[model samples]
Target: MTDFSEQDLSGSSFDRVDLSGSTFRGVDLSGAVIREVDLSNSRIRAAYFDGVRMHGVEIPDLEISGEVVRLVVNGIDVVPFVEAELNRRMPERALMSPTDVAGFWEAFGTMDRLWGETTDLARTLPPEKLHEQVDGEWSYIETLRHLGFAHACWIGGVVLAQKSPWHPLDLPWDEAPVHEGVPWVRRIKPDLHEVMDLRRQRRATVAEVLDGITDKGLGRRVTSATPFLTDATDLTVADCLRVVLNEEFQHRLYAERDLRALGAG
Candidate 1:
């Protein structure tokens, strides 16, 4: 293995170079244009591909799974179709889009039970391994912290009208703007139990909101304004709560995948 730390390789070109099975860790490949590149059988994980434009590419049997914002294929947006197919496969996904208070409670209860199982699986692994990032994804502790941040932003700030509800350990999305008073400390290596305690507190806050929800209240608008959110405009209470539920559901899946990888390692 070659170590090229702190070395500048600008304007370098490799033609017919054999780089198969080479690992690129913490390497910067931004703003570099490639032409006629053969990326067959390549495996990419937890990498950013924002604002990328590809043309004349022959892609067969490609499978992508992540948070896709806008994916246009053949001059058509397929995000809705993809989402519908996913919801069809997992009928329980419909619970996340509940229109009434009773449905919301049921959805929350389901998520609570599912998260309990996920946490139990994580507990079977070594404590130190829980902090390890699998395939460059967020560590188990970081995932829990991010979930707490989602609850703080959506449930506490938006629904309850709190100006700043973020905790010091709350982890924001990578592309989220720097908002004053919002926590974004990525280097804070917290213990698994410590972060789980914070998560329990946030979950209790959600429970409080769920217990007091009414059908009329679900349709009510969230008037709280926070810089953490992309838009400051008012949103329906149902929409805000749905966002929180989706975060919990999806992040648990990611955490479980990483836990399995850690156990195998």
Candidate 2:
């Protein structure tokens, strides 16, 4: 394996390069254009494909799992189909899209219980392993920090109309822009218990919001001036809360999978 770290290969063109079976860990391919490529039998995991435009592409047997939104297939958006199928597979998923106050609280309570179980599993592993990344994915501690950041973004910033609600330990998404007041420090290796304490505090904030939720509040729209969000000018209160729930549920699954891998290792 060749180490090409910190090398500038910009504007370099490869006509018939053989990169088959090559590994691309922590490589940035932003703003790169590919005319023709064969990705048959290729596997992609924990990748971000935001704002990517493709034409004349053939996709078959493609499996995607993550937060998929506004995905258009053949000029038709298939997000609803994907969401409905997912809800059918897991009936509890329907609770994530509740329309009433009681339903929202019930969904939150269910997620809280599920997360508790996952956290208990993490507690069995060595404290240092919680900071280790598995298969190029976020570490267990980073996942918790990201979840706290999600709560601060959705619940505190959007719903509660706070300009900046990020904690010092909160970690934002990788593609998020560098904001003035938001915490984007990825180098700080925080202790596992410290991250969990912050996570518990953020969960409590969500619980407070859920407790105060009403039918009218669910339908109401919230607008905020948070520096972290660029396009979240207008959003429904329920939608913002739902984003937090979705992040919590998805990251819990990711953390569980990584914890199992760590245990087996």
Clashing pairs in model 1? Answer: none
Each model's Cα RMSD? 5.3, 4.5
**1-265, model 1: which lDDT tens digit per residue?**
6767777887788887877777766567888788888888888766788887788888987989877988888778899998899899877777887888888889988998888888889889878888899877889889998898888888888888887788999988765677777766878888878998998899888878878878998888877767776473468888998998898888888899889988833
The Cα error of candidate 2 at residue 10, in Å, is: 13
TM-scores of the candidates in the order shown: 0.74, 0.77
- Cα lDDT of model 2 by residue, 1-265, tens digit: 5667777888788788878887776667888898888888787765779999999998878877877878998899999998889789867778887788888889888888888888888889888888899977899889998998888988888888876688989888775677776766877889878987997888788778877778898878776746766567677888888888888877887889999999923
Task: Supply the global lDDT for candidate 1.
Answer: 0.83
